[model samples]
Target: MTLKYALPVIALVASAAVSAEEYQAFVGLNADHYRASGDSETNWKLDGTYFFDKKVTLGPLDQFEYINKVTNVSASFRREFDTNITRIGGEYFAENGLVVSAAHTRASGDYVNEVGLGYLVSNNFIVRVNAVKPEDESTDFMFSASYNHQLQGNDYVGFTAYADDEFDYFGISSKYFASLGEGRFIAAGITLDDNDGSSDWSAEADYYFSKMTSVGLTYNKADSYSLNAKHFFSQNWAVEARFASNTDDSTLKTYSLGVTGQF
Candidate 1:
């Protein structure tokens, strides 16, 4: 609309062209949006990942290959009610000509493995398949497809709808970054999720004190408030911790800690 916002959009376009090289490993966690009915929630996760690049080597015919393993645990608690989860999965990424991937995931209690896929368009757009399997209840099938669109202003909006237990959701979000003197910055954003027929709104902001450390705060319908802190050991490694408390007339609170690294 205005130059103030146009400049940021141009910057994103410039940064988007750089093709990412081989990816190895990464891990991180947060404790926001921790509840289902707009109450307080928190949990921790420990993850280990090993995988290869997803980019294709376009020749006479495109080709690529990579596989990975991941595992993590998360538990939620309140003054009384609680639900805990453990997840483990394996994935394969292959590009004999067209990119194809398959994955299996399992979570504690009743969470089951979900499967997904992607078809690339330009440098930004993609099509994804999200499938979920239930472990405790009568099998529920969610066959959904979605598109990701990056706006000229660098904002993102996506849409999705399902078949059985049918519903559609629209999400839109934009980010703002402000320099707080010296080498520090604060990034904030507001997100709206039109899930089913209800509209939920949330705003979050994080202060990056330096290259090695930062903290964040979030206010969402699910969690009244959440606080997070992160300390980076290197450009590729970091550790994080978070605590969240419910705001509604519920007793759900969570604390999570985790380490993340790229190698």
Candidate 2:
């Protein structure tokens, strides 16, 4: 997608609403090499979170990837109402949009704000729906859901589905944990996407070496593939390298390398 087309969707999503718990703080440098276009770009990223109290937190996040030359940055604030009740929060994306949300627990059942801004929560599943109104354009609604089951210990399976005005996709994924020498486990997933009646699928596999090293490979029905590897030198430091290619059309390829740190 071009910048003009992407910026609006990103802005709309940001205006609507958005998770991983990796590090409390981090910064990184990245290099992206695009073979099909014979172009190389440098990227920088920084992100951090601060706690004001046991129930309140603030976050400043920023990231740069070589996709359409877009950079993402956001400021977020979250407050926990109680341990298993409602947690209210909102985020503002720089020059983008604003999102407000609340998350509840299964014991608390489902909830909807007076303005329709809440999600359904359960012990094993979650569903969220939101609407976005961008200036001078039609409103877009997005919905996503995930279901997870724990077979035993850390072994589990999951299903995810997402839909919006212009996109629809669904995926099923699972991971099995065991001791195979230095390797800990393997994970696999397949995603099907309906892109305006033209459907495509992608498959992915990942192997984890301990908790600090891993490699992943992905292939799409559109004749594109990607490989990425990550290794941590310490609990607080890591490096990642990735390569991607498309065999069709101009035969494009992209490579990236990054070093990261966590507080």
Candidate 3:
């Protein structure tokens, strides 16, 4: 590869090694192969959340900790195509069902900041809005709302709407679970994404042999399909593998393997 592309990739890999996400933490690597381009990439990711349950005074300022029932600090790093993206954020959770979060992200040499507010309207619905500002770029907004209702054990239907600068879409998704045997269960779901002019849909089915092992298949209206499998060695560690392909122009394909751990 040319030096122009190589330097950024090297820097990203180095930066990701030191930086670390969710209330659940994970680190993983992905090996990806592109069929059409005959190129391959190895991606590294680290992210997780650490929570402070008790109030601890930090210097002279308590900030919002007085009203914060739960303080969660999160960090994430992604290294791909020889470039690095890093994010650090914190969330303040209040007992009155309000959550506020702020995060800063850096990519290459540019930076962006995001602020988000969310509320749990009820047990089945949530509304969220996020404002994102990137240095030297136009500020953008994203809004999302979702509602889910359970009909029986582990079976439910849901609706979601999402909007951003480029396009707005809304759709419904549902999961219906059935017992296959003594310790096996299967689930099937369908999702539709209605864009500004056209609509795309996908269907998925997953079979779980136990609580920790499952395999799934997905077919999208975009003439793409994927097969995926996951196995958990323990409560804290798991691995995943997937193969995907498309039938459109270029007929691209990909294969990937990754592992994750929660702390």
Candidate 4:
């Protein structure tokens, strides 16, 4: 694929378990609000990975998020390059459903620096742990794990686990999917977050019309429904976008666009 559509490989889409070698990537554009600003106020990213002889993968990602809000130059709520982040890492496959991965991430604004580990379980489960630290302070750890079980045809059940003070403490989730003929899939999932630091329940869905075109939506208890879309022009090219209301009204809602391809 061209570099334009190669960015999605790193962005987080709802991922189902897959083989060790076969992988996925995507990228696109987005509009979070009908801003009067003259700028695209646009953001972009690139992400992708290749299985190491079908065993492990060297994964890397680069992302820039754009927030569009107009205010005084001194306004803290005004839009800025508030969250530019980049991550690069690798994953090692152990037997069974066990895979260990580590990544280093850097953030702009107030996001602390972090390094993390992820594990994928055979029971169709996923878990992640990250340690974030200030430039002058020690490490602070955060952890989360989630699993989904297929029941009957397209219905499934899942639960979320969290540790060390994140917005989401824990949640129970369920999802359903329907395959509408060839190359078309529609899916939806609902989850309720534990604790009350800000987040609540969330609902999301995606309708993939083809290998190259798709649309999606998400609603969080903290805000309104967000819009998501994607299009892949060819086997080697795809673009994707996500836009939503700021979960924290005190924070700014934003949009992210990404592109990707190999040399």
Largest lDDT belongs to which candidate?
A: 3
TM-score of each: 0.55, 0.59, 0.71, 0.58
Q: Which of 1 and 4 is ahead in lDDT? A: 4
Alpha carbon deviation, residue 43, candidate 1 (Å) = 6.4
Backbone clashes counted, model 3: 6
Candidate 4 scores a C-alpha RMSD against the true structure in Å of 12.7
Question: Candidate 1 local accuracy as lDDT?
Answer: 0.51
Task: List where candidate 2 sits over 4 angstroms from the true fold.
Answer: 1-23, 26-29, 37-116, 165-183
User: Which digits, one per residue and each the tens of the lDDT, describe model 4 over residues 1-263?
Assistant: 86666656433222322311222332222323433234335443444454343221111111100110111111011222446665555556554545455555556643345565666654467677777777667777778777666655333555666666545455566666554655465667787666656557889987777545778899877677678777755445556676665554523555656444422
Which candidate ranks first by TM-score, i.e. highest? 3
Per-residue lDDT of candidate 3, residues 1-263 (tens digit): 99999999889656433321122333555566656676666666677766665333211111111123465887888887798989999987667777788999998999999998887676577777888999988878778777766654334556666777566655556555554545566667788777776888899987877656789999999889889988878655778889888867455777888776655
- Give the alpha-carbon lDDT of every model: 0.51, 0.51, 0.68, 0.51
lDDT digits (tens) for residues 1-263 of candidate 2: 99999999888546323211233344555566665565544433333333221111111111111011112222322222332333232322222222234322222444333112323354456565666544345656767666666554334566767777566433333333332443365566788767567778888887776556778898989889989988878766789999888768545877788777655
The local lDDT score (0 to 100) that residue 237 gets in candidate 2 is: 78
Q: What's the lDDT for candidate 2? A: 0.51
Arranged by TM-score, best first: 3, 2, 4, 1
Give each model's clash number.
7, 0, 6, 12
Q: Candidate 4, residue 44: CA error in Å? A: 3.2
Q: Give the lDDT of residue 186 in candidate 1.
A: 59
